[model samples]
Target chain A: MDQREQGKAIVITSGKGGVGKTTTTANLGTALALLGKKICLIDADIGLRNLDVVMGLENRIVYDLIDVVEEQCRLEQALIKDKRNENLVLLPAAQTRDKDAVSEEQMKELILKLKERMDYILVDSPAGIEQGFRNAIAGADKAIIVTTPEVSAVRDADRIIGMVEAEGVNDPDLIINRIRQDMVDRGDMMNIEDMIEILAIDILGVVPEDEGIVVSTNKGEPIVLSNNHKAGEAFNNIARRLEGEDVPLMDLNNSDSILAKFKKFVGLS
Target chain B: MSAVIKTKIEEQGVILSFNPDYCWEEITSALAEHLQEGAQFYQGSKLYFDLAFKDWRAEELQNLINLIESNILPETDFYFMNQSSGVERDNKATPKEQPFSPRSAQENKYTKTAGNDTKLIQRTLRSGQSIEHMANLVLLGDVNPGAEIKAGGDIIVFGKLMGLVHAGATGDKGAAITALQLAPTQIRIASVISRSPDEDKSKELRPERAYIKNNRIVVEEVNL
Candidate 1:
């Protein structure tokens, strides 16, 4: 493989909170690892660490990103190997500290060192347009903006996109999460077209509202590992798209039935 | 050569002057025609006229000013100056700074009855950022997907309105939202909340207006 292709650092962020930025980062990191690629996920939300717990590696973190940046520990010592996959590692944030503990220069240096060993470096950015968000996106080669179908979420996503663009990150892709199909059919919620038209950015994927995602996160297991969930399959498709595959979108309109599969195959509603 | 028209803008008003080498009559006629062609663009804007190095008499200068003023759209300010009259080099007369405030005196005239009734927001309300204004609110740019706005009166977006908007947020019931593209994620007028339909099958994409009618948010096409 080309040395430049060894690692591609991507930051998953949203301008608004509670829109699945960490969840998307964790799932995408795991999904990419399952494809036999060596992946390292960095939880850049320093003060409020959650990616490690979502990835089920919180208990195993004896050293963290701050320790490595502060030179209290070696980079290898801070890398926590996942129980499910040895190839997947996590650099958890320090929960006891704040975002100020890590500077933008330190994040860039850490990602540079990880680039030498990993195939992908996924950073989970904290919500808001503050220093924490800037720190998370400092060393990113690309950014993934996660949002929901709701109006508030889309508005924040647009503002974040504008900010990122102003910082010279152009063409950031979008991921619309927590879309409820029934509500969409009933005209109670904004649909995918409404989001795409307003945001006007390239869409990475759309994840449906899956209860399995909530349960899996509670158990410290990524939903992507559960093949039974529609959200899981949607995330897997997103991973494939990231890997440059042209897989068609999952038929979310007619989910959970054989007829849905038939509809997906026929490319019809 | 391009027309060399001189304008001296000041705090009091704009003053107009023309170069003696240029055709004053032709240029003045051209300016009047241009103003007529694009009245809305010049309306309410301030300009100063400078007649430097021109030998035109005071009566001629007055006639030019009157013609320009007559051609100008409503609310526009025009000031005239002539070098012959020694008003061009008056150091004490300073040009007014371009008004940076969103609301101007003329705009205020339209909104005075609603005095101090309009709210001005200067920052981009990011996702999770929300603002509730007791009166009419105007945004300079987009209201992103995760952001929200609630105003007691009309809401106008100089840019896109992509987030949730609640006009007449306190149940005034007659509030409306107008935008370059009114594809809001969620819109509410009084007690009614509605979302824009999916764009895949919906073809009627144009500038639109949303208002409350019979306790429901109704969207209608708007012609610019």
Candidate 2:
């Protein structure tokens, strides 16, 4: 662990709204913390924060990003510690101010200050190519773009990929969220292959559409905290990948035979 | 009336050659007629208005953009270049040269110009990326869906051609398009346009060529 000099900052962004950027940030941060890495989650959505609530740390936030930027509160005082995991903390966004309240320089400075003390900093960006989106990616070294299988989401994801590349973050990883394997098998939804063909990017992980995500969100606990759900396992795999571990994608069909058959069909086995 | 607006398919989009003699209404009505006649040709491609050296009020230009967006090409992206509000846009205006100019005056005497400038691209064109060349285009990689390539001469793809491509964009009629695996969302040659079937009918992959024959675009397998 001491071999690592400084932490890596990753900004998770999706050009479209409601594709689960916040949920992913909360869950990935929690999963990384479970792996014994100190994680700091930043809600950069400003005036529309959701990571704190999703992580069940909404009530513990006594100060926020704006408070720290304005020097009204110390950076340490603004960070809210996780109840379950002592290694995880969250810097909640300011609900009262818009994205204009924090400049890109201020956001970068704040992340730089936190980088010395953490192993990974995950920034949850807001939707659209606006000031908020720019401010979110300003301090990041890596990017994780989230998109669904729907055509609109994929199109927006492509646009976001272009924008991210233009902003000097090259070859950002993709996470396909809310993919329904049943619909894909029925030929009703775009499959993962079709998406990869169009987006032309490397996939980080694919999360199946699970109702347990809603239950976990309502309970204010990330699904990764639970052991029974496949979605939780998928997130845990993502955390392991971030830790420089090579983990095969979980079989969404919940069977080894079908995946084995697929591997054989593709001549991979 | 036909000379009021000359629509030319370029890489950026459709460039409407502005004739300074016509009034705004006449130009727009002519443009509307052109769009109606080739609505299928202009579909899925952005429209660009090159108002050469013309100074119009901002509101008037906005009205034109609004009319086109609301009435025609609603799904298409519309843009206007080289226009200034009240001020003379002299610097932006370059003298309109004849599009796809022949190499030499002596070459004009022959029925067919022997050489057309060809542009070669070496990488896969992803979605939202576009390539427009005034002559020929040779791509060495895949043209993914949502990407477009417009060329005035011919288009040859050494890899899969899955995106939109317009050959003979200057109305050459003799221009052709060929690809190793041609399954494009849409293909246009000269003034004709065709789209892929709703379902991919053919299970076999083959190198194919597309060209205008008897005023319609025809696709046939070509042996390399």
Candidate 3:
């Protein structure tokens, strides 16, 4: 196995549901693939399976994670190639089975086998800190916690961080998704600082609330693939950061005058 | 906090134990300092504490156990040899009385009382979760947010509070939250809410008490 092939497995998780864990995973995996890394995205949500659909690779699934774990299919038979990128792969979760069908050790072994060929293994964890969450984090060397700007989401993220820490994974990075900066400025929503004060972890990225993301999800394509979407650019920046590049965060202020947008359009950015 | 001398013997792989009353803070600090001074030399060394007259609660004992356990390599096993017969008896007695004696009467009185004294919790607070129970809201363990606990009367962490806390939520302000970790996300006593300063970050994680002062809550280092 190449050194990069023995890659770190990172589980993208949020303790609360509806906080965009699958969206972040698909976007990050796609963005990383665009950067020329061999990436495998595993949907560990089991019965609630959606990452495949979000990544636009649902129809290609024949064998799945449960199949590989149960010895009904080989590991390579389960990987669905991303239509947009040859280097990107998806290990779709079985939609018909419950989370208990796969054990933690089996999950670890599956990742270890994949590690021998992939540059990154991104496990999309299920919502709630239960058996599914534990299985997703079983083999991950790192974790990215996603939360919204609401008190409930932030609170759940905090709990997930503590659990991850107790599991001996220190310094899991934070990603505050769907942030409405306007609400933050108006004090109607919790600010990034409020979250950082409570989470006390290094932030990896911040994704603004973008209608384009919802539209793209509806169409079964992650917004990260589109160059025009601001959220796409943000995910790209996250990918660069993951590659150890110090990319400055995009200023999400909507007050950017027409002149600024015109300038950005002309590559004056 | 009194100072006590602790010695690590290479031959017996034992940490010479001193009485907890002999100044726990000093003794622990001194031992830590000594270990730091000879860190390279002491690396990979096993520690067996000679707990003779030392009396420690389960948490305190667990903390010490963790300290010794972490000091050694993962592959190496370590043990604390309790030399005193009374120490075991003391340890057993503490847990039985510690959780019950202080609150049994108060719990009875509160349950019997009604109305203005009632507390209500709307949702499950996860770990890291904290709530200022302005009255008497009881929760099953699920507060997951590095939470805070502030009650005007009594504060209980059904789950875990890895954040900040203040009991006496309404400023009966004389309230306290009892949890595995006294660390809270924020603490409120009556009209005042204060948080633990970032400066106290260290390995000395313990259950603590917080109270209100000139419109602010102050946390004091304490033992349960």
Candidate 4:
């Protein structure tokens, strides 16, 4: 059962900040783990780390990624086991150290070590195409770009796609997060087609604007662990697709019920 | 004797070549007058005093430093270089330095030739990237939003232009900006600045050119 060479490292990046890169990483890691795959989520945001908190493993962190890279602790000591999933773990970024503390070579070596133990290593990259960004994509086999349905977000995604390709991480997938159905119905927002036209990348999944995401995030639980929310279902399908499953795209238009609309209006879902 | 103090603007800093015959009094007065006349050009710029074998007393050097410090911004730094024989510093002139200073007699001689030069970039300019040139600029790709292009002369973009652009940056009123799709965030030509309209622009995309006319910037379609 040790198919160590089959381990795939995917870096999740978005050039702009506040576009749900961390949230997507947390949900995707959680979803993949629920599928019985060995998963290690690495929060590479360094000083502004959030993946640990998003995964509800912040309190369990004793040794972080920096500790392992700097040889202060063994790799296993830095891996925080998820409370719910036995197959899932997290390597939290150093809250005190900045991105410069970890070099690209160090990141490459660390990912190589993790690949032997984990089936999938999901790297949550920091925003901006700087040294931190370069380090995040250095050892990744593929990239998943997260973007919103706004012009600014799409523009930034285009830039990030170009940079990702230039780094030789070919054929990055796109995940359009936080899509509002009502806005699209009113033609007030850019639909999925317009974003695909601009970014020109294969769509992985689309998560509709879900209030459940905020609740789950505040609760330090990934939305994918919940079965009721549409976003959770969407993330589950995304995980299935990553595992080479042919899951159909979630139909956001037909799923908009009157009760869901009322819940959105009252800010209570 | 009235000795000459030649001022040269270089990449390193502004070099004031002090003639050996000039006394401390002559150097101080001439430098003060030059500073007063072109205060804007010297603001926040480093200044170097090239004393051509001219040695100064300790008190005289202190007075000169005080005078220049009081006149310019606090951020501006000044250095002294004695190019006497056996000195450690290299005496060779900078090969790529462009001597330019606004509102001075040297402006007409340097800026005109610099403005005539053109640069061609054959790739897309992405966000957080900026391109600034002393002359005309021709880009053969898209200029994404959050990127910026500034030129002393004209700017020509072969593809979509959605970034902030400034043509005729050095006050060349005749300079223009032409693009395949001219939907930039902001446009500046010479002293005039304009932005895209706040209303919805769902109209057809067309090639357009922007130029300054009657002291205002105007955009017009490029007839195919």
Work out candidate 4's RMSD over C-alphas.
19.6
Q: Estimate the Cα RMSD of every predicted model relative to the unseen true structure.
A: 20.6, 21.7, 21.2, 19.6
Instruction: Compose the digit string of candidate 4's lDDT tens values, residues A112-174.
Output: 988888889999999999988998998999999999999999999999999999999999999
What ranking of all candidate models by TM-score puts the best one first?
Answer: 1, 3, 4, 2
Give a tens-digit lDDT track for model 1, residues A1-269.
55556588898999999999988988998899999989999999886778876876654555689889867689999998888888899998876567887888889889988988898999999999998999898888888999999899999999999988887777899999999878999999999889999999988888889899888888789998986788888898899989998777667776568456535742211
Sequence-dependent TM-score of model 1: 0.53
TM-score of each: 0.53, 0.52, 0.53, 0.53
Q: List, residue by residue over B1-224, the lDDT tens digit for candidate 4.
A: 22356664443446777665666677678878877765645544446777546665878767877787677754455666654552323213453333233333224424443533577999998754778765578999998765678876689999989877888766567789999899886788866777666433554668899998899988899999
Off by over 4 Å in 4: A1-3, A254-269, B1-224
Write candidate 2's Cα lDDT for B21-136 as tens digits.
Answer: 87877878877777677564454444667765566688877676666665554344455665344222212234352223333211331232244346688999875477876557
Candidates sorted on lDDT, descending: 4, 2, 1, 3
Candidate 4, residue A150: the lDDT equals 93
Specify the CAPRI tier of model 1.
incorrect
Residue A10 of candidate 3: its Cα lDDT? Answer: 93
Q: Which segments of model 1 are wrong by more than 4 Å?
A: A1-4, A255-259, A262-269, B1-224
- For model 2, report DockQ: 0.01
Alpha-carbon shift of residue A172 in model 1 (angstroms) = 0.6
